[model samples]
Target: MTGKSLSERIGDLGRRLAVEAHTAWLAARDPRVAWFARLLAVAVAAYALSPIDLIPDFIPVLGWIDDLVILPLGLLAVRRLIAAPLWSELHALAETASERPSSRAGMILILLIWAALLAIVYWAVRTSPLH
Candidate 1:
């Protein structure tokens, strides 16, 4: 059999990578994906922050290899599980998440809700007490 040209091989690789990325993006939307995602996210975080490296950053051209390669590869692996159609749905979910509240405002709203709930509980407890 004849060998494939470089361009054809590259195209095939690109298609495979794209499919993997889309699959990963789809998987990210499912609650079932949480366990594996969390584990991968944790590992990625550790790799980013860890002192160890395949090519230490002090070595100039080689130093950033981990940053350029490992992180992207890990992310791609995660993306491979994501489904393509769910991407739009996830975008909508992301927009809703962002529009709801900034973190500070969300925290304040949660505190206020908890205070109101506590007040109701207190009233119920006091009003119903035989003591």
Candidate 2:
């Protein structure tokens, strides 16, 4: 282990961590993985919003180590709770999101509806000074 190649090791770790987090997120988005995904999302949010850190942020080189290490570990742990069918559905959803839509009309309809809701919300908020 001469020279110790710190950069290479860190890069590899980063890649793995990203894949794990993404896989968990995708799995959670699927209806089959809904329950587990919601739970995982909650836990991740809690950890992110909590002021406390597993590894305190005072250390120089490893201040945010918990963010890197703990998140990936939690993602992997959530991944274990996912089922095969849900994973398959999630992969299908990913593929669908990448493909161009077949119906421009449908997309336009959805956009119009969203825009209308946004307009209504904007009007309501603007009229209400408390908001």
Candidate 3:
């Protein structure tokens, strides 16, 4: 077959992931995309970055399922919903960004958001109306 070799396919996957990541970042901001699409893009990016998984990797089979099955399916769903022209444009932009961007501020912001959520939950539990 004239298809790519195993090594080539592996390289292609690496490149494709970079492009998808770039597209997701772009989609999060582009007004041309629908709100739901934007949200999906953001969620995908967050899921990739998050250390905590839907199923933790320590578990035998089920843990890998989230990483192997769920994440890819979710990304595929997002890709199908995204406009082709926009995806292409974002992919081109992603290709140019060979060196990934840094965002300490973004990390801090995310941490703050989690902290705030925890605080609210804590307060609610401490003053439970049911109690």
Give Cα-based local distance difference scores for all models: 0.62, 0.67, 0.79
Model 2 lDDT-worst window of ten: 16-25
Error of 2 at 36 (Å): 3.4
Global fold similarity of model 2 (TM-score): 0.47
> What does candidate 3's lDDT look like per residue over 19-129, in tens digits?
676668777788888999889988886776579999998999898778666666767767787888887887678677865787999999999999999999999998998
Give the candidates in order of TM-score, highest first: 3, 2, 1
Model 2, span 34-121: residue lDDT tens: 5856688557646655678877789875878787778867766775677766655655654555454589899899999999999999
Sort the predicted structures by lDDT, highest score first. 3, 2, 1
Q: Judged by lDDT relative to the true structure, which candidate is superior, 1 or 2?
A: 2
Scanning candidate 3 in windows of ten residues, the lowest lDDT window is 14-23
CA RMSD, predictions in order:
15.2, 9.2, 9.3
- List candidate 3 segments past 4 Å from native: 1-15, 99-131
lDDT of 1 by residue, 25-90 (tens): 444446755677746645654564568888888999789766678866886555454454554465
Candidate 2 runs further than 4 Å off? 1-4, 45-58, 84-131
Give lDDT: candidate 1, residue 43: 62
Q: How accurate locally is residue 104 in candidate 3, as Cα lDDT from 0 to 100? A: 95
